[model samples]
Each structure stands twice: as structure tokens, then as C-alpha cells.
Target: MSEKNREGKRSARERLAVEREKRKAADKRRRALIVGASIVCVLALATVVGVLAANAGKSGKSSASGPATAPSGAVGKDGLAIPVGQDTAKSTLTVWEDFRCPACQAFETAYRPTIRQLADAGQLKVEYHLVTLIDANLRGSGSLRAANAAACAQDVGRFGDYHDVLYQNQPKETQDTFADNDKLIELAGEVDGLNTPTFEKCVKDGTHDSWVQKSNAAFQSGGFSGTPTVLLDGKNIYADQTITPAKLKQMVEAANKS
Candidate 1:
């Protein structure tokens, strides 16, 4: 072969060799990058899982931390559904209460948090039915007025807040007289976004008087001899001696599993 042709052939072979080496190096770098990225992804996922496990353990040790329950079935005549949680498909609880009853007030204070938690969790539902069984004075015009006021609050989409505030600001049973029209307006004012004029008109006109009667009818049919009778998913929640938060929570938890 000629010297010039041989030199050209050698140059071509050297170039091919260099190109192969460069290709091999690039492949190695890409593989390394892929391997490194996979490792980082795995580590990140493991770290997230570990954090979740730790948080769950800590929550299990605490009293306040737990799974939320549903409360979808708690439909009230006052347009107050369970405010804190979603409701389950089959689980429904009902609360029959008399506004002036002290035991009802106690239940309101005690079981409210658990109810809110479970309701927010979407595991349980709570319905409220007003019973006029506190005193003779509360039965006639007084009970009707209060019950209608609550209904009017419901009309304005402030029933839940109004219900809570009413129980929170309940007067001593010995005070004899319950909330008058002025007091009802004042209590209604405590709830945000409640139209005072409309509520006042409803209360004055007894807009929810029929609702009060229906509640009474339900109270009678449900066999609630008194106020603050709680039914869990249809069955009555027994409060033998004292109605407590723990007991109420237990009731809801039991219902949740079933």
C-alpha cells in the first residue's frame, strides 16, 4: 500500500477508537446518574414513610389525636347538619335535648368535642331533636319561643353556632325563667352572619312552631323520658350514672367499628 493511503487509514482507525471511548464514557455517566437518582428517590420515600409511622405512634399515645369519624346522618330541622365532620353512609346518632334541662347542658358540654371530632372525621352523624320537658314554664310559650328562635337561626344558616352558644351561655336552672325574646335576639347576635331582623320576625311569628311539635313527637316515639338522651346509630347510648366525654367517645368508637 502507498504510504499516504496507509497514513490516512491509520488516522481513520484512531478516530473510530476515540469515538468508541467517548460513547462508552457517556454511557457510564448516564448509568451512574440513573443509579444515583434511584437511590435518592428510594431514600426520600423511606424517610417519608418513617416520619408517618413516627407521627402515628405519637398520636396513638396522645388522648386528643386519633382518626376522625363521619357524621353525615345528623340532619336537624333547624338546617344544622353536623358541622365538624362528614357523615358515614350507615352510621347515624340522634341527640334529644331540652334547652333548659341541666343534664342536657352537661351533655352538651361533655360530648360536644367528641361529636365534633367524629363528625369532622366523617365516621358518625348526630341529629338534634328538641324536647320540651324541662319545666312547666318552658313548655308553654317559653319553650316554643326558644325552640322557634333556634329554628330561625337555622334558617339563617347559623344553627350550629347558635346551638353551641346557647348551651355555653345557659343560665342556672334555679334562675326559673328561660330566654326571653330580648335574650334570644342577644344570643342570636352571638352567631356570625345571622340576619337579626329576619330571625326576630321568625321568632315573633313562630316560624318553627311546627318543628317544635315534630320534635316533641319524635321525643315521645323515641322513648326519651327526659332530655339529653343520646342514640348511637339507632340504639340508645346508655348513661347510667354520669354522661361523660370518655363514655361518649367510647360509644362513637364502638359504632365506628360496627
Candidate 2:
């Protein structure tokens, strides 16, 4: 063949190869776009499904107790608030506690044994009223947040577990180790029955704050200017560390007799 003819043949072959490469590139782009679109749709669907699940969980978690009835500015046990013990006990004891109050902790450690003994024996029922008086000071915000988180857990029927976990992992009442919103949610997550996100939202939204406020009002109305105030059978009971199990037992025994 002539040189020119050979060159012409070579040029035709190169043109065909270039067209094939272009077509291959277009096909690759088309596949990539389809894959990308599928991924996006899947992500969107997952998001919608997750949202529905959360809403369903929220509805399921609604408390049987309605809003608390605060008459005489005192919190009622009817609401989703944690009442400290089962409601059907023969006798009732109400305790106003501050989460960050050192005296409150002391009361728990010292009087808890007797109190639990009474509850276990079916002699008395205890209701812990969370007071926010200390929280008026900036130092008590941690306590307030924890209280709020606990109320959230209560709303979801996980108060007992959340209550135990909070006190168990309670941070020091110092600024450095203070409990924050995140910490409160973490504690809620530690509880077996608590839903972390719902509980967190409840805390963040300040839901059930009125109950806490009512507790504070009760503190004032009951003349308990401080925390760790114990009410035995609707009457205030006060004593120092020397207040013994025997004394508590006598008190309950008398209340029961009457």
C-alpha cells in the first residue's frame, strides 16, 4: 500500500478508538450518577424512618400519671413525678432533697438505712421532693440539671433506675466536677429503662419544671428553710446525726399505732 493510504488507515483507527473511549467515559459517568442518587434516597429514607421511630417511642413512653395537682402549693403524687416509693403504703414520709446539698447526702447515707427498713417492712412510704432552692445559686445548676434529667426519666417510667444511677455517679458539688446537661443525659442512658434522647429533650425543654417549682413552694410552706427536711406522716421531723434507727422506728411505730 502507498504511504498516504497507510497513514489514512492509521488515522481512521485512532478516531474510532477515541470515540470508544468517549462512550466508555459517558457510561461511567451515568453509572456514578445513578449510584449517587440511590445512596441519597437511601439516606433520606433512613432519616424519615428514624424520625418516625423516635415519635413512636415518645408516645409509648407517656406516663400514666397526669400532670401533678399542686394544691396549697404542694406537689401531688398523681403526676409523673417520682414519689420516692410505691404509692400504696400504709404510712407516708415526704423528704425534700437538694441534689447538691451536702446535708441531703448525709441524710441519705444516715437515715437511708432506717427509711429503707421501714419501706421494706411495709411500714412506711417515702416521697422524695426535689427542691431547687440551692439551685438559685449558680453553683447548684448541676443539681438542677440532674433533677430535671431525673424528672424526665420519671416521666418515662424509669425514675427508679435513673434515680439510683444519678446518686451512684453523682459528681462532686464542686465547680470542676459539676454535672452538666450532657452528663445528665449520660446518667439517663446508664439507666436501663430510660430513652436517652427523649429524656434529654425533656431536660433541655424544661418540661415538668412546674413540679420542681411546686416542690420548692412546699419547702417554703412547710417551713423547711433548708434541705434534708423529713416529713413523717404529714408532720415535719427534725434531728441531727444522733437520730438513730431506734428513734426512727419508734416514730414510725407511733404513727402506725395512731
Candidate 3:
């Protein structure tokens, strides 16, 4: 064989090795993401974190106790879910999450792009059920207040952008920074036209607090293990350690094909 051809073969092998290393590195990062705060479950969280007695007292309040004033465009049983994306989408992704949950923030940061992509493409629709797990698990109204603010966003048709903003600005789990209405309203300024007087009033007045409580109740009754309980067409995807943005895209594409 010519020396030049042998050199060419060596170059190709080296390129393949480089690609393999890149894939390995990407997988390692994904593994780290899975083991971080992303996979925390409520069952373990209950023992790991102590809820204040005052917070615990309100954990079981039913919608009948007050009006479950759902936001405009809310759907699902009892209007618990805040829907995003086209209604004509063939696949549905349901997510139960708390704005104050670190695990939820991690999950949102990692897969939000892919989820939004699929939802925007009309292949999938996302139904977000805002829960107050952290408020009940920890010792603050952060979860409740944040969830209420997100609901208020839905009322003004800004839920999608405001929801992402909340996760992006999530504070330390122990700090309870989200419990402040001013902070939540301040964060709303990041999203265009989301920080209006009405939005500010909704945040301060807790307009959707009862709706958030109802959603939390539904999440608890649904037997979900934790915050960011993501399901693709009724199958729990977050519990699957192998799940990645690429895998999620493939799954949604495959669903479209089927």
C-alpha cells in the first residue's frame, strides 16, 4: 500500500477516536447531572428536610376550604395544569414541579431547551402543574408564593416565559428567597411585558394561591415521588437515569412517527 494511503487511514482512525472521546465526555456530564440534585425524590426529602410545624399544618388544605381560582387557559382535572404549546400536538408532557426546589431548577436547566423545542414544533405539548413541595418540606412560603406567581403569569398569558425565568433565578433551597413577593415580581421583569402593574398586584395579592394549593394537593395524591416529576405521555421519564435531551428528542420524534 502507498505510504500516503496508510497515512490517510491513520488520520481517519484518529478522527474517530476524537469523536468517541467527545461522546464519552458528554455522557459523563449527563451522568453527573442525573446524580446531582436532579433526581431527588420526595420520600427521601421528607426525612432529609424538616418542615416547620406551621407550614405542615396547611399542607392538607383542600380547594373547598377556599376558592381554587384557576388562571385563564388552565386545563386538566380541576384545572390544575398550566398548558404550554399547541393544543394540536400529538404528545403530552406533564411536569409537576416547585419553583423553590433545587432539583426542579436542575431539571429545568438541563432539559428545558429540548422540551421547548418539541413543544414549539407541534410535536409535544407540556402541562405544568405547579406544586408547593418545598414550602411543605422546608420552612417557608417560597414554594407557595412562587407557584402562585407562576399561576398569575398564566392569567396574563406569560406563564411560559415567567416559568423559565423563575427557574433561572432560583435561590438557595435553604434561603427561602422566593417567599418574597417583591423578589418574584422583580424576576418577572426579566420577561418582556411580564412585570406590569397587574402582574405585580397578582404576585403581592396571591391571586392564584388557592389554585397553587389545589395543584399541590393533586400532585400529592398522584403518588409522584418528587418535584419535577416529568412524564411523557403517562410514562415517568425523570426516574429513568438514561434519559437525555437527545433521547427525549428521539422519543418525541418516534412518537410522531407512530
Candidate 4:
């Protein structure tokens, strides 16, 4: 081969080598850019997830409703009324009621004395469960607010007195009067020593609102359909046609005898 042709061929090969190196460098740069972008995207997603998880934790801690510390001498927990009779009583009477229910008020008015008498006499123990069904049905928060107030009163050792007073002065279900914390405080005056500043603050602040929510949840989970559901010794007395206010005492007596 001629010297000039050899030199030309060698130069072409060197040019090809340089071109390959440049292409390789460009490919490396592109791959590095892609990897860096993927890492940034992953980090951003992780940060967003972390923030959402933190917010969820805060919401659950602040708004989750659960049991509270039971009042002195109370027999039950989580906003259930302490049994209002001797621990050794022969019968158990469970009542599910809503403060805003007119039927509940009627039931309370008709049978309050009998129930209190039996409980006081140590023949039966009454367990009151305050619920908020009316509030859910009536588009008002009155029932829940009143229930919360009752729980607060329970904390102050005046649940029974305050409970009767509430039923005695129950507002018309449509009126939603119990939604006003001031009105609830006014009713508290009916029960001796229940209208203290502490009580008032507890009511206004809805200190037991979470407890009320939990109690209402329990009522719903129990598969109960309505308020003023009366059970005698675990049997639903109201579900039977034969039970009446006049017969309630007799029934309790019968249950006690049995």
C-alpha cells in the first residue's frame, strides 16, 4: 500500500475512536441525570407520606372518643351510669335513652319514682346508658350536648340527680334547647351543688363530648333501634306488648324473685 493511503486510513480509525468515546460520555451523562431525578421523586413522595401520617396521628389523638375515668362509686365504665343500687341486688335494669326524646321523657316521668324507689330499696340496680340518636335524626346537636353535660355531671358525683332533673325539664324535641350550654347549666341548678363554675366550664367546653360519642357508638353497635329501650335482667321488656309503666315495678319484682 502507498504511504499516503496508510496515513489516511489510520486517521479515519482515530476519528471513529474519538466519536465512540464522545457517544459513551453522552450516554453516561444521560443515565446519571435519570438516576438523580428518580431519587428526587422518591424523596418527595416519602416526605408527603410522612406529613400525612403525622396529621392522621394528631387527629386520632385529639378527636377519637373513648372511655373516661369513672366517677366515685360507679359500677361501670366508659360513660355508662353507675348502678344505682346495692351491688348484691338480684335484678339489673338497663335503660337506653336520649335527652331530646319526648318518648323518653314520658317514660322517665311515668317510671322515675318507681325506678328510684326500687333502686333505693336495694331490690334492683339500674344502669343508664345515654345516647345521641335524636341528634342524628333531628339534625341538631342537642342530644349529644346534653349527654356530654350529663357525663360531666357524673364526673362531679351528681349524675342521678342531674339525670332526673334533665328528664323532668326536657324540652320539646323540636326545640333543640339543650344545644345551648347555658341552658344546660341553668338546668344543673335544679340539682344541688351541680351548678358550680367547674361544672359550668365542663359543660361549656364539652369535656366529655368524646365520651358521649363513644357511648352512642356503643348503643348503635348493640343493634338497638331507638331510645328509651328498657331491659329487665337482660331481656328487652319494651319489646313485649305486655310491659307498661305500671307493670315495670311488678316485672322487676318478678325478676328479683326469679
Name the candidate that leads on lDDT. 3
TM-score of 1: 0.61
Tens digits of per-residue lDDT for model 3, 36-124: 46545363445322232233222222222457799999999998899999998889999988887878878887788998899989999
The whole-model lDDT of each prediction reads: 0.55, 0.56, 0.79, 0.68
Q: Which sections of candidate 3 miss by over 4 Å?
A: 1-29, 39-65
RMSD of each: 24.1, 26.4, 5.0, 27.2
Ten consecutive residues with minimal summed lDDT in candidate 1? 55-64
In candidate 3, the residue pairs with backbone N, CA or C atoms under 3 Å apart (3 or more residues apart, or in different chains) clash, namely none
lDDT of 2 by residue, 1-258 (tens): 999999999999999999999999886764344222222111111112112112211111211123533222223544422565556667888777766665566456556777878888778877767765444543335554566667777677676567667666755545413235666665666767676676667766556555555555555566555666666777666533334556878888787777
* Candidate 4 per-residue C-alpha lDDT over 117-168 given as tens digits, one digit per residue, 9 for 90 to 100: 8888888898888777656654566776777778778878898899888888
Q: Once model 1 is optimally superposed onto the true structure by TM-score, how far is the C-alpha of residue 70 displaced, in angstroms?
A: 24
Cα-based RMSD of candidate 3: 5.0
The candidate with the higher lDDT, 1 or 3, is 3
lDDT of 1: 0.55
Clashes of each: 16, 0, 0, 0
Cα lDDT tens digits, model 1, 1-258, are 999999999999999999999999886764344222222111111112112112211101211123311122336543333332354434667776666666666666656787787777777766677645543322223444566567667666677788887778776654434436667777777788775677776665555555565555555555445556667766666344333457667766776777
